[model samples]
Target: MANTKEIQNRIKSIKDTQKITNAMYMISSSKLKKARTDLENTEPYFYTLQVALARMLRHVPEMEHLYFDSREGIKEEDRRRGYLVITADKGMAGAYNHNVIKIAEQELAAHPNSELYVVGQVGRHYFAKKGVPIDIHFQYTAQNPSLHRARVIADKMLENYENGDIDEVYIIYTNMKSSVVVEPQMIQLLPMKRTDFAGVPADVFHEEITMEPSPKAVLDRIVPNCVMGYIYGALVESFCSEQNSRMMAMDSATKSAKEMLDDLNIKYNRARQAAITQEITEIAGGARAQRDRS
Candidate 1:
């Protein structure tokens, strides 16, 4: 059993920690709200891009480009796969980071020879410990997610894919739905395929607009932009999900701390009362014995 002073100090320390956790919870909640709104806005743009790209594919049926064609018959010497694993820069978000790492490990289980790209500190650490071969580690100083940062990451993946360092690029991130719901998602980012652009809008589906250079030239430019847009969307989703997870985890911690404080306070009061009663009883006995002797 700890002495009164020791117990009191411990309680004080826990109270201070509880205060910090509560503040963090509030901060996470506020950020989650803003992130949620941003993610919602991006959804429409993603759909629009998908529709536009689908339209382009429909209008150009005879497009004999790698972006629209299959390379199944190509030799194994011609292809390499790249996996981009995105996670939170910090932890304290329950299993949020763990789930992403686990899914990525599972997905890459069969591809030991594939190149790995990591986007966050958590994922980088996990894969590094697992002996995963990382070809690139993207670093960002932003405390929050930025579209520009995401575009840079997109460019890195695109450049590698186009330069033949990677045959296919895949993005792994946590998809945000709500504060309580975050799902891990794995999406292919490269080898720009026509089938990947299946959701284009009907109106823009077949507009035969002339390009300034040529169809191949237009696609070459648009493909990178498309990759950038997709990566930006994924980063937004992953950040939002991280905020939500942190908020939820901190909420639970705050609640648990409150309960523990309540229990400890009750125990301290009971111990103090017991000690006082014992002192009073001893004094009463001493007084009675003295009176009898008198």
Candidate 2:
């Protein structure tokens, strides 16, 4: 058993660490709440955008647009692909970053010709160190998932698609199903199929509504906005998942620290009592010897 002083020092160190873990938990909780609120506030606008796009597709099933090009003529194996991967800027979040990176690695293995567009420092550095080529590393956007950031990403993707740099685009991100459940998911962003909009509420208007200029012209405007909304939604979901994971990890760490403190306190008390008992015995022995000598 260690001396009382050493035990006391250990207890103090553990207490300090516990304070840091508790603080991290509280911070993560706040971020999680704010992320969810922001997503809720913007959901209605995105829903409306989706409905409009769905209605347009229904109005003209044969509509051909650059965004809808399936590129079926190109071989799947040979077609150039782009993946927008969302990860965390920092990691203390248990397996959150690891899970995302694993999925991204699987995707790249399947699509050897794919280009990576990573949006977090963690993922960017990991892939860069592994010698995996990154087409774009969006800095500072991972921590702050704002509309402006989403718009910039969407525009860049659309420009690349228009230029035929990539035949297809996909987004890989983490989705928070609930506070306790998070899963990494991937969704196709380009070459959208009409069936993808099947979830949009059935057309409310039965009569033909004439688009001002032309259906194609209207679609051109709505498609990019709709794409931006999709990217924003992904960003928000991934951000929420990261926060929730961090909160859980910190909470667990704080609890473990508390347990250690409790065990150390018991040891400290025992050591203190043993020392006092030894001192009392020594004093009693000295008095008994003095009396015998006298």
Candidate 3:
């Protein structure tokens, strides 16, 4: 009976846990949908900006801009690199945060003279707990990514890049192509290189566009938008990936809970049957002993 009671209690506890997990699964699913919608909505705008920038560059091959040049106005002795890592504000998101952080650490290791900027509470807390230095941390961006927040981060980073406080800028984030497809990507954001414009075809420069003012002026304005777009796009993708990860994690948890509940039910039934068998045996033995005494 004691064993039966313990099994019953465990079964009850697991049922309660399953309920919570199911609820969480549903919640994460809803959030994932919204995040994906936001991601999709922002996708075209950024890609268009990137395309336009590429086209502008192709139009004037000799165009010179501060964006393309890595003129970090500081002396070589004071030169440092900047690395920005995007993660999730909350956990229970599978390997979303883990993957990003792991790669970011690699970036930090690769660039010994690097300053770290992190987006997400998880990254901030993890780094702080590990005593890893972080120069900047945006605590709220992961939960709710916005163009405004992206701009704020971009402005600061661009300023640092321009002033030569940091020469190279790398952004590490999870790129969510779909719910099932999320990959950790580390991309250099500063000193726009020709390779960065891989999206534009090689022969795109064959066409000619009339430059109203000048190609240099046009590129100068468009290049900054390119940077801002990259930052915003990463934030959007990371946000979507985080939500999808949470949803998947919760779904897995719910399924595991169901399996556990099934196993617990089996154990509970076995214990219950054993108790009943023992009770029936004692009753039959007592009856036989009475018959013998009679």
Candidate 4:
């Protein structure tokens, strides 16, 4: 029903939007590939860390250390908890940020004494506007996951745990199961259980292995490195999920824009045809009037 010019303008606007969406999709694909490559490159180191931890635990099955302490003496309701929540720095991704924020809210509701340590700008801004107290000193961007950044975060978390600031530490992040499937997940980071390493096969050796200073001392050094590896893995996984979600969202947008363009083209053709028919009718009427007057 609208004029051809207006429809043409609308078509142009949609075409521009489609270009932007297509560009975003391609960018997200690149990011996702890079993230996966980083993760793959770092996998062996973390796997080795896990194996070392398992071996150490096998050597001293009855050892009691700060890292393995479950803090059973502390009351559940009174114990302070820290949650490291990973979200997106920016969001055009459909429900990626929303899902993470929802899970974080649920966690906070369950644990009223928990402190929120958010990694993304989106999450930080949302929590701030809602008056939810976020750790002011724990500032970090969620754009790119790096080993150095993960190490810094891990050290801070371990320091707080050592200082009795937080009784428990947990990481909330998204895991990309596949290109199209992603789910938000939470895992305990501190006070690790021995059973967690049960699945990892302990090195089999006939000789009795003896640690240099003490098993506890060696474990103390290895545990922090292992913790850093875990944090790094979580960061990488979350980053990949964000990229995957963004890719899907942008792809959908581009397709929808194409559909709109198709429909609009049909309408434009109809409008143009209708205008030409009207002009022909008007010309015929004028000629008929002239003939009648003569």
Candidate 5:
């Protein structure tokens, strides 16, 4: 029922929106590709280090590294946990930001009185709206996930873990598999898992090695560095996931807007044609009636 002018304006508005979304999609595409390459290159090193540590631990049962230290038997009263929630700094990424914050909410609800460390502005704002207080709000590193920035964040996490402020640390972020697929994940960063190592199945190698500086001393040097490497890898994965999610979201939005504009333009053209035909019929009938009167 809209007039021609009104329909024209609506089409123009949608076209402008489509342009913006298209630009965003292109930008995200470039960033996602770079991030994935970075993640691929760095992840192997972390895996190798973890495998070496696992093999060493198997041979040297006397090793007592804090990272591999077990707190599995601790009482409930002594258990306090920390959460590091990673989200995108900007919006227009569909449910990417929302899903991550929802995951954090579920986690916090399950474990009461947990400390929160937020990486992105989106997560920080989400927690603030839910009346959740953040213990640490890191901005620059979250915006740009590079090796140096990741190292700084990891060192800070290590400091907190060593000081006994938190018993366990968890990182919540999205994992990128490909351009269109991103999976949300919650992984334990501190108190590293015993099973996720490259050298776990190599039993022959574990038995033959002898420690020169002692296994415990080697673990003290290696475990923390390896943990840092893992954190860096996670950061790279998270960065890729964010960009991929945004790119897909924008692509969908642009396509939807184009379809809507096409539909509206069709309707407008039909209405205008109908109006023109009615006017032509009226003019012809008026001329015939005038000739008959003459």
Candidate 6:
């Protein structure tokens, strides 16, 4: 049995830890809220663009765009694939980064000749430590997913796709449906599929919509925006997922620490009670001995 002072210190330490975890939980909750709001604001425009692209694809069934075309059996350089992996810059968000990196590793195993573009410091460090080759290491974009960073990623991905450096590109990140529901997923970005656009259902709009100039011309303009939107959406979703996971993890930690503090308090009370009882016993013994001696 530990002394009262030791138990008191333990209680204090746990209480301090609980306070830290609670603060982290609140911060993560705020960040997740902001990220979700940003994502919601962009969804309307992103979905509209998808619908328009779907309509375009329906009208131009035989259209041949590089993004729409597959380069399967091209040269060695053209056969190479690229992976744009997004992860948090820091850890303590449970398995958020770990799950993404694990999926990315599985994808890499499938595409052995692929190039890696690591987006977060966590990923950069992880892949580097894992002895995987990294083509690009973006140290800051994972922490702050901005339009400028999205455009930069878009430009690089487009440039490589056009130059036949990479036949296809994929993005791996965590998808957040709710504060308690977050999972890692990988999405192919290049070689845009008909299904990639506006998520239109088959029964929704069978009627063909008119394209202003030419179907090819309109596709040329909208495809880049659609691709950028996809990348941006992934960034936003991954960020929200990170915050959500962090919030939940911190909340759990806070609860666990509180429970621990309670246990320590119980133990502290027991030890103090034992000490008080012993002192009382000693006083009673002294009083009896003195009375008998007198």
Q: What is the lDDT of residue 236 in candidate 2?
A: 92
Stretches of candidate 4 above 4 Å error?
137-140, 202-207
* Candidate 1 TM-score, C-alpha based: 0.91
RMSD of each: 2.3, 1.2, 2.8, 1.2, 2.4, 2.6
**Backbone clashes, each candidate:** 3, 0, 0, 0, 0, 2
**Which 10-residue span in candidate 6 carries the lowest summed lDDT?**
195-204
lDDT agreement with native, every candidate: 0.78, 0.92, 0.82, 0.90, 0.80, 0.85
lDDT of 4 by residue, 25-142 (tens): 9998998899899999999988888987887787789999998888899998999999999998999988999998999999999999988999988999999999999984345657
Candidate 6 lDDT, tens digit per residue, 138-213? 6588767877788789889989998889888899988886657897888888988876554575436666577768
C-alpha lDDT of residue 234 in model 2: 96
**lDDT for predicted candidate 6 compared with the true structure:** 0.85
- Cα lDDT tens digits, model 1, 1-294, are 555666688789889989988999889878877876876777776666666666666777677776554467756655677888889889998898999888778867766558888888888888888787778888862246666787788888878776767778888888886657999989887777776566444553334666668778877777777787788778878887888888888888989888888978877887788888999999999999999999
Question: How far in Å is the alpha carbon of 161 misplaced in model 3?
Answer: 0.8
The candidate, 1 or 5, that scores higher on lDDT is 5
Q: Candidate 1, residue 49: CA error in Å?
A: 2.9
Give the worst 10-residue stretch by lDDT in candidate 1: 199-208
Question: What's the true lDDT of residue 10 in model 2?
Answer: 92
lDDT by residue for model 3 (58-160), tens: 6666776777886656665555879899988789889999999999788677666889999988999998998889998876887788888988999999899
TM-score of each: 0.91, 0.97, 0.90, 0.97, 0.90, 0.91
Question: Model 5 clash pairs?
Answer: none
lDDT of 1: 0.78
